[model samples]
Target: MNKRTNYKQEKRMKELEKQKKKEAKKERKLNKERMETDGGEIAGQEEMA
Candidate 1:
């Protein structure tokens, strides 16, 4: 029974980790897109100045 509980806990922890990683990846992708768009505008303004 103890070993089974431990196995379940480990499985749960792994699932949580996977979810965290997926969220982090999605956030990074959004940030990268935001930066690209914002950075392009800033660079264009600088060039004009």
Candidate 2:
């Protein structure tokens, strides 16, 4: 019984870690896209000036 519980606990921890990693990756992708758009707008403004 103890061994089964330990295995389940470890599995849950691993799943949580995986979920956190996926969220972080998604956030980074969004930030990168935002940066690209913001940079392009800034460049365009500078050119107009």
Candidate 3:
């Protein structure tokens, strides 16, 4: 019983992590586009980070 619960919890954690990564990627892409539209300096700062 405990083992099953642990497995489910781990799976849930992994899914959450994956979702967060996807959202972050989308945000970065949007930021990059916005930066390009504005100026190259912001994009360069993103690369540095």
lDDT of each: 0.95, 0.95, 0.89
What's the TM-score of each model vs. the native?
Answer: 0.76, 0.87, 0.69
lDDT by residue (tens digit), candidate 2, 1-49: 3546588888999999999999999999999999999999999999999
- The reply for model 2, stretches above 4 Å from the true place, is 1-5
Q: Find the candidate with the highest TM-score and give its number.
A: 2
Q: How accurate is candidate 3 locally (lDDT)?
A: 0.89
Off by over 4 Å in 1: 1-5, 47-49
Please identify model 3 stretches exceeding 4 Å from their true place.
1-5, 40-49
**On residues 5-25, what C-alpha lDDT tens digit does candidate 3 reach at each position?**
588888999999999999999
lDDT of 2 at 32: 100
Worst 10 residues of 1 by lDDT: 1-10
- Candidate 3 residue pairs in backbone clash: none
